[model samples]
Target: MAGKRGGTAAKERLSRDVIVASALALADAEGLDALTIRRLATDHGVTPMALYWHFKDKDLLLDGVVERVLEGVEIPSYPAGSQPEWHVRLLDCFAALLNALNEHREVADLVHRRFLGSTAGLDIAEFAFAALQEGGFGRTERAEIGVQALHNLVVLVTMEPGERALRDSEEEVARRIREKKVVLQSLAPERYPNIIDCAESLVDKPADEGRYRGLGLDILIEGIRARAARQLAEPAEKAS
Candidate 1:
């Protein structure tokens, strides 16, 4: 059988991971729409039928995008005895995941839509459990909860809202802000005092639209830190 070729008969030399990597590269270079089994077959030097043996269809291929996005990254497990720094590790995990998401410019939209279902995401959750263990959490679920909170942070930082609106580049945001100045000035100062006061700041406060994302990340991490402290104190309250 065709399936048997890469399995028992061929000694399983080729790998699913390699196939996924090739697809990811295609999405990176030519945009996600350009990717097809035939294109991947040409890029990978594999027969079309061979590609099917791995992904079957473009839908499965997209799921492969999530797999490749996470690839080899593993969450740090519970440390024995001494406590592992919780905030640093959690931030590192988000940084790693966000960095990977930023690499595939084209397929990022697809990944944003559905990546939490993958095993790699689950491993990240497990790593969170390890952090909770350091914070005096006894059950595995507390760690999972910590990871989930951090995951929300990463998603907010990385995922652009709505079809990106094309004019999404930092420069584009500035252009829009400048263009909105007339509208801002039209408002009565007495009627909308706060808008009048912050109007100049609104038309590109820190400039460089990308900096907005960096600022948002700081806010998100701060929120996560506050939440972690609350979670830690909760257990103490229960015990008392």
Candidate 2:
């Protein structure tokens, strides 16, 4: 019966894309520790050799996962003669990336580390550099600003409140949040006034996740704009 089942599974048509998608779903639901070649073979009803044909090892398979996530980032574009402000375009680009990472935050760390190693990641970086150029930043400045912006966006998603509770049951997550809030509230107000004051926001999920993330993105864009202005001012100051 096992042999018959294995044969039937092998006949179901597995491909590289299929395996990557399955690995992504498995990691999102159960975390990366559960994503292994042998495990994928079992899920696909094939011998371990079948998966190995697609991905020689787990590290290469992780690369494929990062590529898949980055491919979801929609690089914003404008009409040739009707470009919006550079900050606006840049905001949209980073927002798209944030949305993608937020959807599959379990793999966010992987995306961060291998972000520039994939074609899609390069495409996003290219768009960002163009926007930074419009804002008067030179090559070195753009590289520094672009990398910092992407890094901060990833940090924002990974550090979002209640992110670690994603795999927990709703009831359990709620209970934990309640417990956390209670513990925070118990802190002496005189010593930790701010923590006590913001305890609910700290423990409970944000009421408006979009607004919360938007504020973070806004801060990043504003900082870039300020830096760009400062860069432009330096040459004039030196001339005087």
Error of 2 at 134 (Å): 2.4
Model 1 alpha-carbon drift over 4 Å, by segment: 1-18, 38-48, 72-83, 109-119, 136-214, 231-240
Per-residue CA lDDT of candidate 2, range 2-33, in tens?
98776656645777889889999999998888
- Per-residue lDDT, model 2, residue 201, is 90
lDDT value, candidate 2, whole model: 0.88
Candidate 2 stretches greater than 4 Å from native: 1-12
Model 1 per-residue lDDT tens digits across residues 1-240:
787664443224336777788888877777777889888777756567777777779889889877777664545445688644876666666656656666665765565445566888677656656655665555754645554555554555445432232336867766777677767877998898888777776664445435655565567556667766787788799999
Number of the top-ranking candidate, with TM-score as the measure: 2
Q: Return the lDDT, model 1, position 234.
A: 87
Pairs in clash, predicted candidate 1: 129-143
Candidate 2 residue-pair clash tally = 0
Cα lDDT over the full model 1: 0.64
